[model samples]
Target: MDFTSEKKEAENNKNTTNGNNPQEIVDSSSQLSVADGNNSISKEADEFRERQARDLKAGLHPLKSKFVFWYTRRTPGVRNQTSYEDNIKKIVDFSTVEGFWVCYCHLARPSSLPIPTDLHLFKEGIRPLWEDSANCNGGKWIIRFKKVVSGRFWEDLVLALVGDQLDYGENICGAVLSIRFNEDILSVWNRNASDNQAVMALRDSIKRHLKLPHSYVMEYKPHNASLRDNSSYRNTWLRG
Candidate 1:
């Protein structure tokens, strides 16, 4: 039979199989219709979303996954005091998640270093320099870890930054791990020096998370002065 003839025969058979009432057949078919099907699917989607939200509220830590960018200055060239800085621009372009671990794994640990060097973990657009737009008006909270403890301390601090264990992350521009002869340091860079609330909140959060010792002192300094500008506010800051 032709397409139309076949379709007609099928409908006739369907009605006959039912009560032979066309309206009853239509009503029965309407219950299984695409529009109702779509409504059920939409309801299921909403329920699934609600359940997920509830689970998240019930202390289910949200899975956080994202690219992290880091810069290390302890490369052999910098350690040798070659009077030259690494090509900063090239490092910025190299910032990425996988690149971060690859860079960390291939580099010397902080304890093995003989000079003061810094590893900067910041968002891709941001440069680690104090004068960069994101850093210009910022400050950092300094954490001094003894040189002998550099290995464990460095690993912990780096993990904190990468895993976003710090508070006020929106105001956080980056973090730095500075390797010195007698001490290793970790510092948190904030986007605004005037954001006292965010800065303090971030400090408190970190201290609580790490259960830092009561004697540990954290110092805050604007990035420009940290870069060793003689005339910056930090100079006046120290005198005060």
Candidate 2:
């Protein structure tokens, strides 16, 4: 769809609330605190790593790199970075195909998630925030899909990411599935927004992997722009 059509769809869905408000930003410091805490989280990480090593030794297919699944549910009125970080939780990380499915199967699908919730699958060391060193100079390509097809689309993108199907896979940092009242958003983030060749290649890879139609609208938003505006989905440049 064109920008005008996409805008209209967004407006139409504005009143279709899922008993939730909009989302908030995230913080990196809070993530560090969680890692430093002396709790089950630390124990869980140690056990997870041990199991991952065992799986690899047992011949589980290893992925190009490790990835972490992050989850965050935003309060209706809290929008600051600190609150966002506090809300963000590290779900789990996986380094093998089998490990990925083990984690994915236990989680609720995007369609079942409440509004204003986000499921972020990023590289092990990269936080979902725009301020992350790997993401600070980069941007994301976002595609909004109807709620009915959102789950399938999200799974497709996740598989493509872990399966190394993207031509510019090295440039990709991660993908996010944002569950909202209006629509579900799927975004692929890259490491360098200034590399036009890599950016366009990543976009093309998404289209090919998702088999999106010619008229489907996609958006590009630089991390710097999000940092300046304190918004993730606003002021995006439309592309298809």
| C-alpha local distance difference test of each model | 0.55, 0.77
Model 1 regions lying over 4 Å from their true place: 1-103, 227-240
RMSD to the hidden true structure, all candidates = 23.6, 12.0
lDDT of 2 by residue, 23-127 (tens): 232221112115455775578577667866877789776666689888889777677988888877877677776556555555566766778888899988899
TM-score of every candidate = 0.57, 0.77
Instruction: Write the residue-wise lDDT of candidate 1 on 8-27 in tens digits.
Output: 44443332231221121123
* Native-to-model Cα distance after best TM-score fit, residue 219 in candidate 2, in Å: 0.7
Off by over 4 Å in 2: 1-56
The TM-score measured for candidate 2 stands at 0.77
- Give the clashing pairs for model 1: none
